[model samples]
Target: MAFYDDGSFHQATGVSRETLDKLRAYAALLEKWQRSINLVSSATLPELWRRHFADSAQLAPLIGTETSTLRCVDLGSGAGFPGLVLAIMGIGQWTLIDSDRRKLTFLQEAARITRTSVTLLPARLEQVTGLTADIVTARACASLETLLGYATPLLEPSGKALFLKGRDAAREIDEARKTWNFEVRRIPSQTDPEASIVEIRNVSST
Candidate 1:
């Protein structure tokens, strides 16, 4: 099933009209910014709703019902994928981190246009400090081992890390386990059959 527009996006995700409007504005801004800043892949522009919006929106349900009080931090949030999208969905208080100034600029503008409030951190993941979150998210940011290293210090005890991974998820998990010990639950991706959402917790260095 392909999501080509807002109606289809709403049907697929069941977001409210207000949220849909925010997403529409966000999409327009993304398209405009993509022309100069390379916010997303040019090939995926035609399927923006499916490739980006819906894909990011799918993370909402997995976060459970109590989102208002949760703090979510997105590592390497290049174009704000699940982070900004979740903020617009009213999922949680969000902090998005990215090293690129230009991408951070785009995210700031997108959040302004979408009327979604988020904290933007312009720094590499390792340089980020003095912050913690109930949830940490990343998409196409780095290898599982690297992401785990980035997330471990930022995550509160009992917090969870949700990573969007493609077909190499199992292998990545295996490799990650070699350096760290964590419990992982693999949730099937709503947007792509071959992809998966890897939910991890109880992180400790081995």
Candidate 2:
């Protein structure tokens, strides 16, 4: 949301001074670690605040305020785009899951520096079980059909799944309907016109 300029994001999100500090620290960590590992695309690093931070922070508002103490699970939380950012914004009980230990290592340091509490799961999504959450988030992780497969098992009956997708999102939803029965709402992205957030609820096998 016009995060290209400094302070624009803070204004838009209305985050506290403490939360802003944590986000700044997170940006620093991402820049530092990127040289050694591919946390995010090299091109996007120059626009980290707008492309990554803002993109991730946008999910906070979509969540219902009634859903307090939200249990959030971020599937394939690479560089913790929305997951780690959500943790800094104090969303709820956070769990960042990824198969890459290296990425998990980076997330651990980021969480430590930001002074955010998070449960790190360093394993494939299928290996994790008995984990139910209220809000599930996945960004640039997988095809919509595949994401539903992973999320369906971990979501509570009334939970919501917020997935960040590009222009092809509508097609993905159409494809997913072939196997899954659910209610979906599309929210236009504040950053990119071609991108959107797909919110799915009441998911079930067809």
TM-score of 1: 0.97
Q: Which parts of model 2 have CA positions greater than 4 angstroms off?
A: 66-68
Q: Evaluate model 2: give its TM-score.
A: 0.97
lDDT of 1 at 27: 89
lDDT, candidate 1, 1-206, per-residue tens? 55787888898888889999999998898888888888889999998998888888889988877889899999989888989999999999999999999999999998998888899999989899999999999999999999999999999997999999999999999999999999999999878899999999999999
Q: Write the per-residue lDDT of candidate 2 for residues 1-206, one digit (tens) a residue.
A: 58984389899989899999999998998899999999899999878888999999899889854444889999999999788898888887899999999999999999999899999999898788979999999999999999999999999998999999999999999999999999999999988899999999999999
For every model shown, what is its TM-score relative to the native structure?
Answer: 0.97, 0.97
Q: Which segments of model 1 are wrong by more than 4 Å? A: none
lDDT of each: 0.92, 0.91
